[model samples]
Each structure stands twice: as structure tokens, then as C-alpha cells.
Target: MAGGEETRKSTDSLAQESSIIDTFAPEARFECPICLAWLRDPVVTACGHRFCRGCIYSWLEREHACPVDNMKLDVEKDIFPDNFTRREISQQKARCPYIVRGCIEELSPLDVESHMIICKFRPPELPENEKLRCQFVDVGCTDKFEDEPELQRHLESEVTKHLSLLSQAYTKITISNQASTSAIAQQANFWDPPAKNEQVSTSEADEGVNALLRAMYEKIVVLEQKSREQDIIISNMSEQINSLNLSMSKMQLRHCNGCYLWYINDFKNKIKDMQKDHHLMFYSPGFYTSANGYKLCVRLNLSPRDPNYIAILIHMMKTEHDNTLEWPFSGRLSITVIHPIESYRNIKETMMTRPELEAFKRPVQDLNPRGFGYTEFVLVEDLKIQEFMRNNTLVIKVQAQPV
Candidate 1:
């Protein structure tokens, strides 16, 4: 009687401490046998047992057996539920069948679904098996995509990785075309002259002809343009050379002569006379006497009455040959008239003796002129002669001997 009474009290206390009615209060609820968590999508086995979705899913992974009675279970078999008894049982707390402890408070019907998914005490969510028979199970993919169709849809419509690939292919093609064109140009440059009898197909021959014509036309155009430009440059250079020659031909007078003269003829004979009389001092001391001397002197007879009284100028003018002229120095004629006082006195004596001769002779011959005059010329350097006038001239001036 004592043992029996003690058992009754213990059982009553156990029932009071954990009752489905008190834990769940007003709604249907249950704990999973495998995980000791609230039942979500609770399903019954063939043996009239129930468990949570995740708990059973995991248990089925390794061994298909019921946790409570070790009853053999078939996954393919549909779960048959007794809803009337489940509703009644849901109102009271039942002892957790799990080997581990479960939630202290019984779960409400609404919370049961969420509880099973994340319950720490619940068995691990099973790894899906993708064997031929398990078509619905997606093993390695964890994208929240349920099936192959969803994964395929995501890859094709959303990602469109192939479009990027096509763009890359087109870029590669463009680069290849440019490289091929460059290579062809380089090869053409490197090709040696071909043999006359090289055989070629009709199509290849036509293509080659077209290519050659195009290249030849381009080259011809370039050459023509270059030739035209070069011609213009040469013409301009020639004109400049001519102008420079003309400028270089200009000669400055050394005697401070205000006038300039250009001789159009050779004055070699007149020049020889001037040298013999020593009237023109420009000849280097021994130049006229040299064996090879071919010096030129020009003489122009001028009456003191002539509007241009340049006798002394002729004496003072410096001279140079065109071939020997240089920059800053020019071809000019210079004459130095030596008026010896003794000769003038003698002439005076003779004139005084012969009145007739003296009548024709100018008394000034015995006297010195009031002042002297000089001549100037324009000439060029020897180096620039070829560029100047093609022909040269010289002039000579001879003073009349005193009557």
C-alpha cells in the first residue's frame, strides 16, 4: 500500500508539472520525439506515431526508423493523421519523448511551425540526397532554390553570363582583324621580286591584281604630291638665289664718291695706259709688271666744261675685276693724276715762248685745280659672279693730251 501510494503521488505531480492543457492552453500543439522541440508540419508514421518535419527528415537520412518504438518506416508512404485525437491531445502537455530536454513552455499552434525550423534541440536538417529516385532533393545548391527549374531560370534569365561572353568574342575578332591587316602589310614589304611564271588560281589572281592596283594608286598619288611640292620649293630657291646674286653685285665706293657707275664693256686697253702712266694707283706695286698681268683700265674723256666734272674722280676711283670682287669690296676704277710742279713750270715756259701754242693751251695746265672729284661703281664678290649678269662689260676714259 505504501509503494502504490507513493507511485500515485509521483505520477500526479509529474502530470501537474507538465500537462498539454496547461502548456498549450487553447490550441493544438505537440513536441517532436526526435528533437524534443515543438512539432511543425507534424506527420504520423504507419505505426501511429508523429514527429516534427526537420526531426524526421534528419532521422530518415541515416536510418528509416521511428525514434520511440524503433518501428520500421517507409518514406514513400503517406502520413495518415487522426485530427480528432490530435486536437484533444493538443490541449494538454504531454511528456517529451526526446532523450534530451525540450522547451519549458509548451508551444502554441501558431508558433509550432517556426519553432521546428530553428529549434536548437532539433535534429540537424538533413543533407539532401540526389540519387536518381530523389528528384526533389537538391544537395549541393544552397540558394533557397527548391528545384532544378528554379536554378536554370536563375542562370539563364537573371545572370545572362553568355552575353558577356559574346561581347568578349566580338572584341577578340576585331583585334584579330587589325593584327591580320598589319601582318599582311609587313609581309608585303618583306616580299622579294617574284618569278615571271608564278602560277595562281583565277580568284587569287583577281584579288592579287586588285590589291596591287590599289597599292600602286596610293603610291602614285603620294609621289605626285611630293613631286609638286618639291618643284615649288626648287622654284622658290632659284628665285632667292637670283635676288641674292643681284644684291651681292652691289659695290661700295671707298673714296667717298657720291656717284655710282656701271661699265658695260671691257676697259683693258684704257687700263693698260693708266698703269703705264702710273695715273691710277689701285694696281698692286708689281701687279701690272707681272708676266701674266692682264689688268683692265677704263678711260672716259671729259671736258671740264662737261656738266659732270669727274676727271679727278676717274683718278680717285678704285677698281676691281668682276671675277676678283668680294663682299664689301667691288669693281671700280681709280685714277691718280700726278701733277709734277716742274712739268707745269716747263710747260709754262714753253707756252710763254710760243704764244700760238700757248693760245691753244689752257693756262690751267701749269696750275693746280681747285679741288678733285672721284667715281664710284657697283660690283659683286667673285664667288657670286656666276649668279649675277651672264655677261660683263668694261669702260675706259682717256684724258686729252694738253694741246
Candidate 2:
């Protein structure tokens, strides 16, 4: 009879403990689709279905999608519903699902979101500024920045404003220097005579006066020569300034896609007489065909912009066709003027391949295309003429040529 009573007492204690546990634990709405275990903390998808946090995360990892409907679950953007009220449930509660996997703690549904986001077990964020972050975060920038506003400022800073600031600063310094020079010249008393002028005897005066007169005459001659040189320099500079102004005022639209062609033309026409004809051309004529059958031909527009030796157009080519093309073989075509040609007669002969030749062709445009231009050019190598064509947009560089 005593052993029977002991057994009944033990059974009653076990039932009471079970009841306490049931009271403290949160009621689960669904099972984790992945682990087939009771859901600990549930997350709601944009599509309004609930799933275990771990199950949803695993699904996203496999193929960025919701478990039930395959809707895109941008893990970063998905909203995790709050379980703040679940924390108020009694202490005899069940442990979090993650507890068995070494996360030995319980978290309210509300706190689970914060924990999951910063969870070390979770995938490490790709060093921030990753395209996977927020929608506004995935810009074309390869470099990672700390925040959005900083990146925005960087993109907004265009080359034009940078150039303008530099130009303005240069102008400011030039004006300040000129002002200082004018002030010094105005302050100088050039006519002041020395006290020694009153102390000389008649003969000494005559000899000294004659010497002084000769010295003054020599000084006058030197000053006049210097003045003439200064005038010549000023005239040359003025003429250059006027020519530059004229060039700037004459805004032109060039059909030739070669950005450097006009510059080469200016070298040949305006500065040709100043160059030496004996110099050799650096780049020889060549042709290149893209994967899409767009052929490009390059040749010497052999000329210089000044009296010195330098090829005005480093690479110049014209294409034979226009329209859509893939990249590497696509994007904007540009000619990099490696050397500033100062004179027309200096030329250097060089050899190039077909693709290399095409890489430097001028862009072309379709007149119907809202913003573009067209160009046609030929390659002349070894006295042989080959035709090439392209229709790409022209982006004329209007900024002052850099020194």
C-alpha cells in the first residue's frame, strides 16, 4: 500500500510540471518546412505567409525565394513579424530551435529579428555597400562606401565643375600677380637724382657728365631693345589668345567620329609651315574587324599642333557600319591622343593589327537616333587605300587642352 501511494505522488508531480510548461510556451502556428520541427520564431514573407526563420533563410540561400510560393524573398528586404507578446509567456517555455545547434538561448519573436540580422551564424554581409544591401545601395560603383549620402555626392561631382574650379583659381592667381606688378611700378620713383650730382668740379663734371651720358645712352638702348622684345612676346601671346577665342567661338558639329580629327586638321592647316618634313610617322596604317563584322581602318593624319614633334592623333579610324554591337567591341569609341603634335611635318610610321586598329575608330551616329552622329573614313597604308565605315555618336571634348 505504501509503495502504491509513492508511485501516485510521483505521477501527480510530473503532470503539474507538464501543465506549467504548457502555460509558458508560445502556441506554434506552423512547422518549419525545412527541418520538419516545431517553429520557434516565425517570419512573414512579403506574400503574407509565415515560416520558420531558419527554414526561410535556407530557402533563400538555395535560390533566393519563398518556401511555399517561390516568390522572391529579398532576405534583406523581407519583414520579420514581431513576437513581443510571446516574451511575456511564462519561464517554463521551450528553448529556441537554434538552441540545439549551439544557440543556447530563448528569444521573443520580436527580438528574433534583431538577433537574426546580426547573428554570427547568419551569412556575413558582403562588406557593406554590396549590391545585396538595400535597393538604393546597388549602384554601378565598384568601390564600397559607408553610407548613401556620401556616394551620392561623389556621383554628382562632374568633370566640368572640377575643371571650372581649377580654371577660376588659375585666373584668380594671374589677376593677383598682375595687380601686384602694377602697384610696384606705380610706387617706383624712377626720376630721383643722387646727392653727388652737386659736388663735382668743372673738368670732373664734364668728364663725369660725358661718361654718365654714354652710360645713360647705353642703358636707353638696352631698355629700348628689351621693350621691343617684350612687345613682340605680348603680340605673339595676344595673337594666340585671339586664335584660341576664335576656335572656341566656332562651335562645330563634326560628322567624323574621330574626336582628334579636327585637332589634326588644325595642325595641318594652321601650323604646318612650322614643322620639319624629315620626321617619320610613328603609326602605320592598319585595319581591324570586330566580332560583329564591323571593320575599322587606321592611318596617319600625320600633323602637329605647334612647331615641335608629336603626332596629333595617336589613333584614328573610321568604321563602315552602324547600329547595336556587343561590348569590348561596343560602348563609346575613342581616340587617345598620346602625344600633342606641335607641327604637321613630323610623322612616325608604325604597324598595327585589325582589332587594334578598330579599337581607336571614331564613333558614328544615326540621324534618326535622337542624339548621335555619323562618320566615314579610309585607311591609307603603303600607298594602298581600303574603305572602312562606322556610325557612332560623337562626344567632342571642349575643355581646354591639358598641359
Candidate 3:
């Protein structure tokens, strides 16, 4: 019984094959020599032979000859449609190409191409179950599975192993990228050509270095200008500071007590100005008394009323401390005039206050001048001949001793 069943199956298969073969006529009139299939859109050539329109046209392009007899043919003028043969072929039934895969459909020759498109057994599409591969295939994973779910299960089972591989891959990629970047940077910073002569390369390198130096020089110039501006600002500040110091020194001089030294510069110019004004006297600014409560100054006369002599005088002035001082001032006064010549003795004088002397009288009011001095303080000829005018300056020292 098993042998009989096998024989029957074989008979069915042979019948199906025979049925498919019969659809295309074995006769030469229906068969196209090009494709050996039943003629589609049959057309007759000038040589009295028929072929499918496309087959004849393609054949004519290469040789201008009829495919059957090698007869020379003109494609546009010799080919004519064999409408009767086309209609006969269209009515002939053909088995589907998928008949071996259990498709049982039969269609006319004209409808076969369209029917094959929708044929159920035309190698049914690979299901999702059989289309999966390992997710790491791009990273050298060669494993595959029957389905996506199976692949996912495999991945989960070997997750730790896969992760280690991924880490190694990532490290390699990172290192490669870093190396590539470094190579690019090296290429960018230098102009080393493999084929160029050493001398040429060196010359090019020198030019690049010179360009860099020029840029640096320009920056330095800008910095230098900024430095100069800062210097100017500092210089102005220094001048202001010096002017303030000078003002403070003058203030200190105005308030000093005891002995004070005075320097007279431009003595010749001062003397000339006084001479022009017919005023021979020049007074020093007020200095404090030794007691620090009274203000006094000195007067020097370059040309006194006596033509051959110079004169010196002393004066006292009212002050804010007047009300706190003892009345009827009594003090010893000493004065020295410095000669420019070091070897010469400085003119020195001292006097003790006396109530009877008008110059020593107590102040009745501010500027009630009762001053005292010598009419012939020094000889003018001695000043000119004795080197007493060095660098047009004169120095004088004065002291006051309160009794």
C-alpha cells in the first residue's frame, strides 16, 4: 500500500509538469527562438517569419537580420504585428511559476505576469521569525538566530560578555579617533612634504616662522604704546606728588619753631627787581618763635640808605596764640648771614630785648612796627669781591631765645 501511494504521488507530479508544458505549444510556429516561450505580441518580419515584437526589434538592433533565417531586415519597415497569433497565445492557459510550491492557480498567457505578482505560493515572504541577526554584527558579531525574540533572549543571556566586548570596541574607537586627531594637528602645524628637498622645506619653514615673528612684533608694538601711555600717567602723577610735597614743606617751614635756615635762590634777579623798584628790602616769610607761639620774619636790604652798605632787620607779627602769651615780650635774638665763601666768617649778631627800646616794646596792636636792625649790616663791595653769591643763591640762619 505504501508503494502504491508513492507511485500515485509521482503520477500527480508528472501530470502537473505535463499540464504546465502543454500551455506553451511545442510547434515552431508558436515558440519564440529568443526566449523559447510561446510568442507574446507576435509580429511577422519581411522574411515571412514570425517572432515576438520585442525579440525581433532587439535582434534587428544588433544585426538588422531576421532571427530565424538571418535575412537582413529593416526594423521600422519590415516588422508587422501578427494579431491572430497574439490573440491565440492570449487565450492559452498557463500554470503559475509557483505550482511547485503548492500554488494551484491557472491563468491565460496574457494574464500570467499579473497573476504571478499576487500568487499565494510564490516563495511566501521570509517571516519575521527567520529574519534576525545578532545586534552586534556591525562590531564583528557573526551569530544569528531564527527570530528577533530568540536573538533578544540570546543577547540577554550573554549580556555581560557582550558589554565587555562593547567596552573594548569603544576604547579602540576612542584611541583611534585621538590618534587621527593628533595626526591631523601635526599635519596642520607643519609643512613637511615627503617629496620636497630638504632645503626647500627649510626655506618654507623659515618663511612661516618669519610670519609668526611679524605677528608677534606687531603685538609688541601695541603693548609698547600701552606702556608709554601708562608711563605718561605715572609721570603726571609723580609731578602732582612732588607739587604736594613742596606745598607741605612750605607749610612746615611756616610753622617751625626754634632755629630755621632759609635759602634765597635767584638772588641776583631778586636784587635787580628790588633795585628797579627803588626798594632794597626783601622779607622772608614768617617763621615760628622758639616758644612756638609767635611769628617773626627777616628783612634784608641789598642796597640800604647808606650807599656802601647792606642792611638787615627783624620783625614780629600777631598770631592766633597772642592771647595765651605773656605780655611785654622779652627774648634774646641771634642772626647769622651766610657768605658763599666757606673760608669767610659768617656775619653774626645777638641782641637782648629791653623794655625801654622801641623795637622791644610789647604789641599794642597787630603790625604796630617797632622793629630793630643794623643800618650797615655788611659792605656791598665785600659781597661782590668775596665770592658770596655762588650760583645766585644766599643762605641765612636765624634763632630766637625767649627769656
Per lDDT, the best of the predicted structures is: 3
Off by over 4 Å in 1: 1-199, 251-403
Per-prediction tally of clashes: 29, 28, 0
Model 1: ten consecutive residues of lowest lDDT? 131-140
Indicate the residue-level lDDT of 399 in model 3. 84
Please, what is the whole-model Cα lDDT of each candidate in the order they appear? Answer: 0.38, 0.38, 0.64
Mind giving the per-residue lDDT tens digits that candidate 3 earns over 1-403?
Answer: 4554445444434543344445444467788888776687899888888887888888888988877788889887888989988877766776665553456677776566567667665433323223334555433455766444566798989888777755544444221122212332323223222111112343343333334334445578999999999999999999999999988876776657647777888877876676666565677777777444666777777545665676677777677677787755678888787876674578888877665776655556664366776768787667767767789887778886667
Give lDDT tens digits, candidate 1, residues 1-403.
4554445444433443344224333333356667665565677888877776667868987888887788777777835554654564466443222212233345545454456445554333223321111111111112334443454575566344545543433333221122212333422422311211232343333333344444555678999999999999999999999998765543222221322233433333433444455434232111111112112223343223431222322211223332342222112223322222222311100111122322222223322122122332221232123222223333222221111
Off by over 4 Å in 2: 1-403
TM-score of each predicted structure versus truth: 0.22, 0.17, 0.41
Q: State the displacement of the C-alpha of residue 101, model 2, in Å, after optimal TM-score superposition.
A: 99
Rank candidates, TM-score, best first: 3, 1, 2
Q: How accurate is candidate 1 locally (lDDT)?
A: 0.38
Worst 10 residues of 2 by lDDT: 386-395
